[model samples]
Target: MAAEPQTTDHRKRPRRRGDALIAAILHATVQELEERGYAALTMEGVAERARASKASLYRRWPTRAELVMDAVYSVIPDPGELPDTGELRGDLISVLTRTARLLDGPAGQALRGLMAEVLPSPERMGQVRAHAQGMGRQMMEEVTRRAVHRGEISPEALAPRRMEVGQALLRNHFLFHHEPISDEMVEEIVDEVLLPLFNTSPVNSAT
Candidate 1:
């Protein structure tokens, strides 16, 4: 007697696709960053944690730095979303404070790891530069544009370096100093460094 072939128990959770899959992968990346950190994080590790295939991660992010950058960005506020506090100082403080806060999280962890790993390779360094420069610089540019429109500062203040100053200082402190950047430090950066740099007399300096 020929026995009927047993059916396989093929009931598995419906696969996550599109944004859902991306979100799962990103969440897994963040968890890996927090737990194993960037130094130990790998695409295989992220894929395993996400319950997705290694090919899935590789298809989206070709490299570890790319994956880590996207994961860090996923949890942080959009750089294009500027805080309108009605004044340059208020906006500056608000933005800087937000960055300082993020530094205490997965973003900072990724930065420390990337900085260590990407320095030797120019290609990776460029990727890191793009990631670092894009976030804070875009925010600063919008904030500065608003300030200029408000007549709070002159257009001459919008130099590449000027836009980079606040973030550079914050990152320096975060990397070299310690965690949980203080509100007082943020305020000092806004009041002392950023404001002065942006509002400097035209006669005194250029950008």
Candidate 2:
């Protein structure tokens, strides 16, 4: 009899645990978002790419939307670590520009896909909404707090809506418009909108 050939078995690979496994899965998720995009991404696809078990992903994220959201969030620049440009306009522009870049990448794809997914519970949808919006606000808060400390704006300038407007405008244009966001638009947002909104003098100025 002719010698039989043996094939490599992927299943026999050493199992990954804890952070290493989670990191691999998230990386695979982003790769899928970049390649297959969100609509076509499946748990099986991510598991196969990550060389992880589907059950591992399911154990952490019960739904595809949840998995995608977590994966997208993991890749976002941390708000607490954003650089301070020492002035409100510079800081605003830098933060918003970084966000614009994020929206132009896998994070953007994940958002578009998640928007179309029909979750079984309204609560699940709410969680998705919260996670999506919360990070933007947190980033704004980081910049705003720095501005306030530098006396560039009144503490009152840090209203919820004001904090949200820069990100909101960028997201609105990104979601609806066909073109990549322009430098002029980012500047206009900082100069024409955010700067004026945040230009309030101190509350005790008159005293």
Task: Tell me, by lDDT, which candidate is best.
Answer: 1
lDDT score at residue 38, model 2, on the 0-100 scale: 89
Clashes of 2: 0
Clash count of each predicted structure: 0, 0
lDDT of 1 by residue, 21-140 (tens): 999999999999989878889898898888888888889998898899988988877766666999999999889988988888889989998988888999889988888878889889
TM-score per candidate, chains pooled:
0.86, 0.88
Predicted model with the maximum TM-score: 2
Please identify model 2 stretches exceeding 4 Å from their true place. Answer: 1-8, 119-121, 201-207
Per-residue CA lDDT of model 2 for 36-147, tens digit only, reads 9989999999999998888999999998998999999999889989998888888899988988888889998887778667456688778877897799999999999998
Q: What is the lDDT of residue 64 in candidate 2?
A: 92
